[model samples]
Target: MTRGVGSMQDTFEKVIKHDELFHEEVLPRLKKLEEVQEEFRVEIGKITASQTSLELTVMKDGQQTRDLLGRFVDHYFGTDDKKLVLKEKVTLKQLSLRAKIALGFIGVLGGSGGILAGVAAVIEILKN
Candidate 1:
């Protein structure tokens, strides 16, 4: 009975030493692994934020490109709300030479028009 009791006490002592070894050796390693995992989680969060910002920048650049293309088309083809000539680009500009020519023609014909009207009136009076 004393031998059996000594064997049981030896087993209990071994269990306590194993528990102490586990606490001294394994627990610090587990704590360091937990810290490394937390660091990895923080790095992953930073990468996610960077990826989201890059996506937004890409989207903004795409929208700006579309807007520039629209403006280019509008500048070349004119807007939707106005008349346009296809064969020739027309910008309305008045020439003083054309105005001078029109004035000369008016001055040359104005006296003849009044004289012809007066002659018609005279002929009607003679007829009466």
Candidate 2:
């Protein structure tokens, strides 16, 4: 019985640690990617509406050039990959949460008595 309890504790710790990591690393990256996508969409719309067909130029250190969309595409897509990465991270987070909830429910249901008894046992454990 102690061994089973130990295993459960270990698994719970692992899940909580992973949740923290995901919240720190993945969520921020997703937010940045979303911002970049919105900016890119706005720029594309402006570029498309410009009637002159003037070559888009970027000026840096007194140097001006064309190929604005190409450069922007590279930077934008590079950042947007974070969106895909975030989707995978979110799926993992959701799966972990679901598993934790299911484990708690199972612990209640399968522990020899019904819901009230399971709650009592949990309360008793907490009191200790």
Candidate 3:
């Protein structure tokens, strides 16, 4: 009975020693590991924020590029609105030059011929 009691006491002491060793050795290491894990989590959060900002920048740049391309096409290819404005300017300049040339030619016609030529030229322009 004494031997059996001594064996049980030895086993119980070993378990207590193991528990104490784990508390003394493993607990601090685990706490340090948790701190390191928290640092990694913080780093991951920062990386995520940076990635989000970069994505937004890329999206904005892409939108700007598209807008620039649209403007370039409108300028070069002449969208309908722009084409109408350009056509009006050209027509006005041509009409002014034609009127001047016709008046000069009528000057050469002389007297009543000049007046008749002027009227005819005006009528022709209006008809077109």
Candidate 4:
């Protein structure tokens, strides 16, 4: 009867140790997994909302019936009308320096005009 009591006590101690190991190790890991899953759920919800907004914009732009991807294909194949003219690809070295110079000139002129307008406005304010 004493040997039986010792065996029962040993079995109970082993069970308690196993329970303690699981509670200390496995429970924390399970909680971490739950937190990661919740973050993933939130990210997926944001992605879904963004997709819905894009779809709404496409529909509003009257491009719903025309497959959005098909437009790209049509443009690539040069099937789109003049309104959807495909852009010409230009290699960097192949570009006309004259065009670059013209663009630069226009930008400088526009910037100077804006500065003059601001100065004129300030002068008018000072005079007033």
Clashes of each: 0, 0, 0, 0
lDDT of 2 by residue, 1-128 (tens): 46565598889898999999999999999999999999999999888877334433323422423366667887899789988899977874565444545545676778655575456555544655
**Cα RMSD for candidate 3?**
12.7
lDDT of 4 by residue, 72-106 (tens): 77786666454344333344235465554444455
Per-model TM-score on C-alpha atoms: 0.56, 0.36, 0.56, 0.44
Task: Indicate the worst ten consecutive residues by lDDT in candidate 4.
Answer: 83-92
Show model 3 residue runs off by greater than 4 Å: 1-6, 79-128
So what's the TM-score on candidate 3? 0.56
lDDT of each: 0.72, 0.70, 0.82, 0.70
Each prediction's RMSD over C-alphas, in Å, is 15.5, 44.4, 12.7, 20.5
Q: Give the Cα-based TM-score of candidate 4 against the true structure.
A: 0.44
True-vs-predicted CA distance for residue 82, candidate 3, Å? 8.9
Q: How many backbone clashes does candidate 4 have?
A: 0
For model 3, residues 51-101, the per-residue Cα lDDT tens digits are 999999999999999999999987787777788899977875677647755
